[model samples]
Target: MVARVGLLLRALPLLLWGRLDAQPAERGGQELRKEAEAFLEKYGYLNEQVPKAPTSTRFSDAIRAFQWASHLPVSGVLDRATLRQMTRPRCGVTDTNSYAAWAERISDLFARHRNKMRRKKRFAKQGNKWYKQHLSYRLVNWPERLPEPAVRGAVRAAFQLWSNVSALEFWEAPATGPADIRLTFFQGDHNDGLGNAFDGPGGALAHAFLPRRGEAHFDKDERWSLSRRRGRNLFVVLAHEIGHTLGLTHSPAPRALMAPYYKRLGRDALLSWDDVLAVQSLYGKPLGGSVAVQLPGKLFTDFEAWDSHSPQGRRPETQGPKYCHSSFDAITVGSHFWEVAADGNVSEPRPLQERWVGLPPNIEAAAVSLEDGDFYFFKGGRCWRFRGPKAVWGLPQLCRAGGLPRHPDAALFFSPLRRLILFKGARYYVLARGGLQVEPYYPRSLQDWGGIPEEVSGALPRPDGSIIFFRDDRYWRLDQAKLGATTSGRWATELPWMGCWHANSGSALF
Candidate 1:
């Protein structure tokens, strides 16, 4: 009877009409037409000297460009969204260069800087690299009719801002062609006349892209001045914007050229060390050097060893333990359990049953010693150390106590391979011998692989002494062997388990 009912259900004709509902039809086509008309009315019938021949082709192309720029469905039709965007205020294309305009520009600058700050915070918290490599930019130069001397001066000043950085070398082969960097200057009416002056508020005051390829444009509309007041400081603003174009995001440091607001350049405040380092990071170091060698293959793997105590009736006392350990140069006082060797014969594996000191209940993470008998444990974002056997010292007691940022679900463990204390939460932090500093690891590009996950679970040191980490279900490894280079070797290793879940016993049977 059950089989017969199932057969009848499968054979029954589904009522497709039940799911269909009457809804308002889309107006994308009509919106596109309106946008075309608007563009023609503005730029089409401007001057009587120019013959007005408004063709569908022209309007169609404008609509297409608008659709593409706004990232809406590209039907070459100007829909409501496209028309709205066309009428909206243009960024970096304001009319006047007044104090109000400068204020607006300042506001925009701050907005961009704030966005970068949020991004950095996210990176620190999430351990996800959300930076993009390519940025598209159009050029706005001085009007061709501008006096040759004025054009030459503005161009020279603009170029000088970037060229002044000793570490950055500009590619100058193609005079005015497709180079990694492109430059253009606009003068007086030509800049402001098209209702697209570069000097207006929220308009182009000059913007740059990352190192690979970028373009810079100056507003010829503004009264470009060399002095501190009266008009916009050409060299100062140009230098700042160019810094952005060169991949240096705005810095919180006030004296930095990459700082949010516009400040007159001081004699000593040319190119800062931060600026030089940032630019060099993108473009190869000025002094030629060999690229660092990356590790040969993937370093991290996420696996779940079979649990000995799985079933209720037949619980096993001991589970097969995985092991990892590291060697350090020196061991300090207040350090616990040295020469930490765990499982297998890499070199040394020592069980911490005798040397292991039980920490407080909240202490989820702990690290031991290689040279001295001091054990460090982290709880509630703070560090505490157990000296010898009885004495206890909070990290704060030891000058400027620093540990990983506090999180409710924080877990701490000692990485025997790296000789560092590892903190796991939204992001991973490593506290090495050189004090509690944030780890600096190159983030892998996620564009090829959808997006990065929030929590990274499994972490293990490979046989080759490189570190391996797992995000989501995937594994990644950092080859310390190839420390100084741009690209590192990556591999996708297989693991039977779904997550990187394990506990390092830190015990070896040697």
Candidate 2:
């Protein structure tokens, strides 16, 4: 309706625009209601035809369908949880049959359980699959956040996940030739139509076409990540989109990889049991006729052929986002740092990297304070805390004498006690919300943190809330809630979080 209204206004220029602007839009519930309607329309929960508005009963039913698809309570009301879930980052594919499709998935699960060799169903009016067993894919581009090698490694691994269980095989397409599947990234509105255009961010992570079309598109606006448990894992998204390119539609089976939502990549097989069954039903088992091989695997390591350095290679002009050109003083007097900007009125803040060039973007010390849920940044003994858009309160506070050594080696949020931990030299300090200069028997020796040597560069928390500390190439994984290092090894190959994979694609040699 909004699109049609715009077309009408453009066609009838003589009509007065003042009358349309004269009435103020309602707020609170009315605003929520409009947003909900648009949300449902955008994702195919409701009909988008230019008919009279859906009756209240039909609209309520649409809300219930969205709730069911989004794994929320099936209450038809526009409750707070439903609204919040709608805002979460998710696959851009339309949920054309949100509720009924999920119900089919439940039935599909049971039917597949009863007969594993049942013929597969196709979802499209056009060709839903490839006739050839071998397929080649090429990356048109990649996100800047992760290294090219890492991204290709993730791609290879994602492709291998499918080939491991089915007859389908994939190989990287040569630079000069055509490929069966082409994956590309775009910022916004790259001629894919308004409905399919990549919305700046937060809506529709990526969209894909059926098998014969042989293409997948990701929103470059997304904070695409690798094996790290932050942002949207590109490997996971690539795996799911590959499913679409192979003619697999969205599966609402809660445990299936093709679910509309994302999940944290775990230590187990990336493909779920249902995912294996679905692909096998379509393409059948490998030529060897051996049992399906699903293993707890590593990221592929045959990256010697992949481009290591980007074509731009960190050039000064290409450092920042393309739209944000030139530079500014970036003035903010209070001890606060800028973050995400949802509204397009202002440019969104980039993650502080020394490579941004010509600007003071790097941070000396950074920590998320658990107490007030604000981010704290420290530079040259000066500190700033950001609450929201502004750095409220006169924060540029002096480094409090919080009983820790000067120039700590590393800082990470310790999930065990819900506090921040700082490592300096051979001692560690645990600081609570406004603690004393030092706590009793505190500034504990680094020895308590297992075999992690002093002067660790940084630390990251695992999905299970365990801490993995690293310096140079080595890492020590610790269950901080209990004992010392549970595992320690060379990080590049051993640690899954490093994005290194030992996976071998099941594709037969070409």
> Largest lDDT belongs to which candidate?
2
lDDT score for candidate 2 against the true structure? 0.63
Q: What is the TM-score of each candidate against the true structure?
A: 0.27, 0.54
Give the RMSD in angstroms, all C-alphas superposed, for model 1: 25.0
- Give the clash total for candidate 2: 6
Model 2 residue pairs with clashes: 298-501, 298-502, 299-501, 299-502, 300-501, 335-384
Q: Cα lDDT of all candidates, in order? A: 0.39, 0.63
The 10 consecutive residues of candidate 2 with the worst lDDT sum are 325-334
Q: Which segments of candidate 2 are over 4 A away from where they belong?
A: 1-27, 48-54, 98-102, 108-122, 295-510
* lDDT by residue for model 2 (130-150), tens: 888999999989988767766
Residue range 26-118, candidate 1, lDDT tens digits: 445565466456553443222211245466555655555445434456665544455555554222311111222223434555687522332
